[model samples]
Target: MNEALVLTWAFLLAFAVLAYVILDGFDLGIGILLPFARDDDDRDIMINSVAPVWDGNETWLILGGGGLFAVFPLAYAIIMPGIYLPALFMLMGLVFRGVAFEFRFKTIRARRYWDWGFIAGSALAAFMQGVILGTIISGIETDGRQFTGGAFSWFSGFSMLTGLSVVIGYALLGAGWLVLKTEGQLQSRMRTLALPALGGTLLAIAAVSAWTPFRHPEVAERWFAWPNIAFLSPVPLLVAGLAALVFYGLTSRRELMPFLASIGLFTLSFIGLGISFFPYVVPESVTIWESAAPSSSLWFMLAGAAVLLPLILAYTAYAYWIFRGKVTKETGYH
Candidate 1:
């Protein structure tokens, strides 16, 4: 029962994360793409495209963090301290991003600063998230399940590279979203951006994949072994196929399909990561089985999660449905 409860929590945690990356990711991408807008009018449209749904989109992040803390307190306690500085910066970026959304519309005089805030905040948040992921994948320093890493232990060449990679990936996602929401020259501009962003994302993926195996021997062994290799082969193959599909969609001027395909590529990459580090939640440290809270505690929380999660999903779907279709100069949060 404890095993089942832990698995359930892990599954929910993954779901929340994937939802955030797919939903909030494009908006963050939009923020990253903010500087490229031709003028204030274009910027307004871009901002308006996301304004209605952006705040709601972030609920998944809160859910994921809360769920992790509630269901796997030990893992949370260990991992948080190890990546404390990056995580702190990430939250600040998010706060800045949220504030920018509110303040950008207020006046012509202050718009420039808010715009910078949005872009820097989004980029920094994305980079820090990538750094956090890279740091964990590279291995967190732990002494008997307690984090022992110092202030800059999470910073490294590989983590920095991954940070840049995430920025590119977010840009691609943002471009895809713009293609769906805008038309004419704005869409055309996004099209031009999308192709290069796509290529950059693939390059980042390749670089990360190449170095990941060498940087961690256990990941190398897990992936390169015969049966595991055969089983996991489909992930990369599917990612390649999705990348090809995204390229074709962009060439064909199909808007939503490319974005969906981009999501698929990310999904496959995440799945590969999950497979590569199956038992461990903190990479060579605490396993899920080892780090989960007491069974009774988990069961108590399970009931609340069961009721609340579905309502969140339902409201999210309803919100999207209400906002469906192309955005225009006339479209806005009001």
Candidate 2:
């Protein structure tokens, strides 16, 4: 395809990924933070905070994955086989959490079981996503057309560290959502969670920065090169500054701004990763052009997405508008 078309497609794919991370990130964060909730009341408050927006948030994931599958079939084919287990686990986690979310509020007696399921599902999903990311960053073991690696090979020490990092990242998002949507003790509790989660996330980013390049020399070189280095370096700096702002906002009791700032941090970091691995879809294995489906197929998929994606975005915005306000004890999914 022409360069302009390629670039436009790339940008759309990137936006979809960013939307997924920001939208689903918070609900997953809520799920991760569920276990730390002190009691049933706290849990209810936490769930309510995300109920209006959680499902809509997941639309980004669908958009991102579906867009990639349509536009870049080769990348999808290679990466899917390599990370199949983790991908399946992530889906299961999301499904489990989604099911538990509805069931949890249906009956008082079954609430505890569903709550635990939500927590487990959220944490599992987050960790699996991180692991998949780490595996991609660490380089997948692919031999020509297929993944030659063992089944459990994706679960390494480095992958686990990335998983933990994601857990903290989600917690930070959850904390921010709570800051925006709740008040009183719950807000205070979220603030308490936000600070440490922010610290852990930063540390994880640092570690990943160091480890990723060491593990993959090409990526390291791309990052350290003069022009690329200068262009991409601002991402981390922005992330750090936003993180500090988030900390300050939380400490000063600024409320809603902390969540916004946290989202900024996440967005910047995500952009950095996207920039670092621009042309490549499956780490070192496949480039976007190489893995792209036929032009005719892409055109067809693009047409469908053109209609569906906007409708999803509009409905999501409408849902958020409908539920805009502080959550209360009386307000819940019954």
Candidate 3:
């Protein structure tokens, strides 16, 4: 495959992953915050906050994995085997969350069961994602195109910490989302939640930054390298500044800006991670070129994406436009 084609496919795959993380991240955050809700009313408000957008958001995750399988078959092959257990757990969580989402609003008798299911599923999915990410960042043990690592190797102390970080991060995003989508007491409650969530997220960022370098010397060297350091160092600084802005906005009760700032902070943090592992989709193990599928396969996948992606974007935009206001009891799905 030519370099131009390879880069194009890689860019598309990256975009899909970013979109999934940003879109689904907030809803997952909302789920994480479910246990903290004061009552059923609060829980309903939380569910309504994400109802119009949650299912649409998951499209990106589907696209991401599908695109990777089509365009980077080798990376898919390598990662699936290395993190198969966690991946299955994540998928199961997602399925449980989806089912709970619909059933929670259906019957009062099943409400409690579905509510807990949703929360558990969301936490499991988010933690499993973190474990997969940590395994990738920590490097997989492979031999001749096969992963030779233990089945449960992804679940370690560092990975668990990262998982908690993701939960906190998602909570902050959820709080910000609630701030934007709610009013009165609910908004106030979300604002209250945002502060601590933001603090926890920042601490997680710091811990991960400090820990990652020591865990992987090559990664540490890359961060401290001359030109790369100068170029990439601003990402974390920007994340810190945006995080501060989010806190300030929340504290001052600037409702809209707080959510926007939270999104900015999350985006910046994602950028930092992407930058840290620029060339490797599987962290230290496989380069994009090494893992990419044949040029023919990529072109075929691109043809489908050319049509499907625009349709997904159009529908998502339409849904948002249709539901663009504070949700109320009367506004919920039947």
In order, the Cα lDDT scores of the candidates are 0.89, 0.85, 0.85
Question: Tens digit of lDDT per residue, candidate 3, span 209-319?
Answer: 888888878877888889878987888788878988998899888878887888887678777777778788777778888888888877887788899889998998899
Error of 1 at 229 (Å): 1.5
> If candidate 2 were superposed on the true structure by all CA atoms, what would the RMSD be?
1.6
TM-score of 3: 0.96
Q: Estimate the TM-score of every prediction.
A: 0.98, 0.95, 0.96
Candidate 3 clashing pairs, residues 3+ apart or interchain: none
lDDT of 2 at 26: 89
lDDT of 2 by residue, 111-168 (tens): 8999999999999999999998888877778888677888887889899998888888
Compared with the true structure, what per-residue lDDT tens digits does model 1 show for residues 258-280?
Answer: 99999887888788888888888
Best-to-worst order by TM-score is 1, 3, 2
User: Candidate 3: where is the Cα deviation over 4 Å?
Assistant: none
What lDDT does candidate 1 reach at residue 121? 94
lDDT of 3: 0.85
Worst 10 residues of 2 by lDDT: 1-10
**Candidate 3 C-alpha error for residue 103, in Å:** 1.5
